[model samples]
Target: MDGTLTINGPKHTDGLTVERQEKPFHPIEHVDARLISLLDMAADSICLIDDHSRILLFNKASETLFGYSAEDVIGQRVDILMPQKYAEHHDGWIARYLETGEHSIIGIGREVQGQHKDGTTFPFDLSVGVAETENGKQFIGVMRDLRARKEDEQRLRSLQTELNQMTRINAMDEMGATVAHELNQPLTAIILYLQAVERKVSKLADRGPITSEDVEQLSDLCGRAIQEAQRSSSLLQRIRSIIEKKEPERTTCDLVEIIRKAHKLSLVGFSATDVFIDLSAPDDLPPVSVDPVQIEQIFLNLLRNAFQAMREVEQKAIKISLKIVTDEEDRRDRLQVRFQDTGSGIPDSHRKNLFKAFDSERRNGMGLGLAIARSIAQNHGGSLDLAPFDEAQPGACFLLTLPIASSPSDESEPKTESSESMDGSQ
Candidate 1:
């Protein structure tokens, strides 16, 4: 029985069979109908390809898969099933294997691209097996459609994303109390300082010459008061930037200066820690079109989150890195910022909804910070994503991406304007 080919008989130990069906065995022509009867009822798409990757046999399943009747494809080249992009390389693969006896897909099951009757490409998982015979070498491929499985997986991911967003919104609400209190302290201080300064200035102006020293000190105090007012205003701006449902207004701005200011602003509450902000961009990394203030808020939120995650750890450090990246898919430039921390890592359970608004893992925190942070990132035509904090140790890293301007050196440098002295005409 060795080397004897069979259509439906059990495979022998030495690769032989009892009955061979080398040629088409039609029940009407042949004495036996067993082989033809077996062919009519298979559930999977079955096809036979020769050494040159030309279709030799097509079954009922093959017709249903490619929207073609068996008669239309039985003698055609197998490259018709592959998409245009894959067809070129596929011919080379077939020829190479025919000569070298090397097989990448034989006896293997894999996910591959398939072109339908309408020329639409879809995913399919195909399992292929090879058999040798007196007529020629043939490959039998059993294909399973994967569109349904892909859809189900996509639905699950969408639901998970929604749940995470809900959790983050809740976290933000919890943090509201802390944010409000922090903002109020500065506002209240600015009010008291302004009132005191105004009263002192009015009394001194009404009395004597208000000596040069007195006037100079008063001007210094006024500048300090203005700075305090600006601080309070900046806090409100940051909060409103997240909670307000509005799109970012893009403007050309210096990224290096923006990062420096944001880093300085974020350090207000973080004490007892050493942090570093590092920025590198192509000198040609042009002033990107972005909502500068909103970008600042995003950086602040990420920096604050990193600082909080690392605050309790012994290392007590966080780093901010900014760079320009190219998007191969979109064919555009992107402004990328990475906030890396050396702190206690996030628990496995919390990773899925980490960017969700108000989804805070900490009991005392309202999860809104990261959620709002992500919202702002998206509003600016970008995304915020989290990754493993470090390769060697433990921690988490957050990535912020924004669309960059077309080029860096496009603007004409403006002439510096002089400050004019104002007369108190009013």
Candidate 2:
């Protein structure tokens, strides 16, 4: 009889007998350990899920990205990491993939929202892969948080907007210069023609025995026409000088007169139904050394700002008062004009940057008015500042000071015979 030899353990005497035994084999143990180590070392989050959509593995990065611990996420459904809308369709997607091997998002990286442990959602880039394991089919996903990238994008957009605004301002400056240059010749011609017409009208009045009343009326009309024409020419010249950045032509001028002109200009299109203005100036105030046109511009800007600030207020009023102030440090006299408004006061937060260019609080403002006004004052050897806030009265006050013209010619120049005190009200 054919017999097989058995190893010496417990011998069977009937014949030579052999015994065999088999041990359980697990192919994925060592490989799985190595894969988990690699996944944990990755910067992006990595998650592994079974065919049932249950999380089989969650790496250290996934824990950090989702603000969840591995112990909390593993064995749970993967939809917990996704937003509600995405989670609702996630199961159907996996089911369809299982049925038809059609890969819609597999291997394609795309942006999606990831829900955090605290219930907040953030953007992330996700790339998914399908694999066949010894146990079953599974999905592997790699995700990268996009919060930093999104912040960088927002910063870039803000910078671009500022650049665009600066570009627009530069273009406007060039256009203003061109317009002023084009307007100069026509404006001069208009003033000259008006003057010639006035002279001719005056000659006619002297030649004929026109009724005294008619002659006086005609002279009055011609004088007014010539005065308006001259005013227009002066306005154009001021614009040209400003656009060309010419140095201001300083002269001795009545501060009260400049204020009156500026106030009139500021109220051109303003409605008086809800607003009142009171202007007071002393007749004994001395002349100031300043660029009259620039000072007028400053006054106009301040008045316009006050009007706009009080547009929504029920009781709106602006009071302008002029007084002579003496500097204690140098014993020098200066003229100060105070503009007080009964409107919304400036907040402490806005006061620091109120005169800074491009830092306006008003929605439709360019934030250049106060800056330009202050610059003009400084150039005139004067200063513009906001007066101290008075809690008792809720409003804003602006004080402008200019050095008094002390030249011998200013003192000897016939004190303007006009001692008319102005108390304008509207």
Candidate 3:
């Protein structure tokens, strides 16, 4: 008879075996024992199965992998190593495979989840191979755990979320500092003007008929107070909207008025430090459409930076000038304002990236002032540029140029003043 396997005194197509009557050749038993030892000592977990999905052979590595002894696994159904959830459907999978001869995992490698003897499920990468023998077919499977990699990925994702939150908080904090310092001056001015008007009106006798001149003066002061207060309220709203992630509310605005408001705020810091301002502008200027609140923010940032630059100087002064120039070639018009500081000029090396985000040169400063200023300028269809400072007189000049409204008829002309033209500084 041909060589074959026999179990319980019955022939089976499991493996090749010599007839009982014939002498064993080529030390077959020794070879089999060495092969089993090699599989037991393998670094990777190994499992051997027959074509019927039965556990024909399992090494020490496989026993440790599935938390089962070799004796408990051998000759058992493969579903014993699977979790209860998977075991319920494993029999049907085997039956379908046997009938169709289709292979999903055979000769392929993929990722899967596996169960441990302690009722824990973990991720694993698996590779399967098929082996054909003289009497029967078998399969070898290798598996590796992925718990460590999965844990590391989760940690990285959490850190990214935390970093994003911190960035937003820092942005809001910076914006708050700017608004507080810039808006305080104009607010104080408005209050002083209102007080002055009240003092003048109180001088009249009780039930006295107030003159037209008195009423006109009082109305003018009240209107100014209302305008300044409205400006402050609008600025606060803009800052709040930014913190809340809402789009900035933009509308047609007078560019000259926005600059005047910014200058008013900066005057506070200058006065506190005993700095003087020399402001000049054309008699009449055209208005540029933009977000008034954002333009004010731009001016506030620039003025603050300029003031901080000259803080150590004995004579601190700021010069502001506005003009309207039309582009002959392109037929485009622009409103330009120049803010110059009589302070220490920027170093050549630092000037290259002065407006860049996080450009830190001033001591104990956040270095985001110029960056925010430039962003605001750009958002208003305008730009901020650093001009060459005079070497003899140390100072820096920032030029703000905004696009003029295309339809000049849409709005009234902007009011302007010369160096000596503005209302007295109270």
Which candidate ranks first by TM-score, i.e. highest?
A: 1
lDDT tens string, model 2, 6-48? 3232223334332422112222325467778898999999998
- List, residue by residue over 112-191, the lDDT tens digit for candidate 1: 89988888889989888888865566777888888899999889656644654454355357567666676787777777
Angstrom error of the Cα, residue 116, model 2: value is 73
Q: Each candidate's lDDT (Cα)? A: 0.66, 0.72, 0.67
User: By descending lDDT, how would the candidates be arranged?
Assistant: 2, 3, 1
Candidate 1 vs candidate 2: the TM-score winner is 1
Ranking by TM-score: 1, 2, 3
If scored against the real structure, what TM-score would every candidate get?
0.51, 0.43, 0.43
Decoy 1 TM-score against native: 0.51
Model 3: what TM-score? 0.43
Off by over 4 Å in 1: 1-43, 204-426
lDDT of 2: 0.72
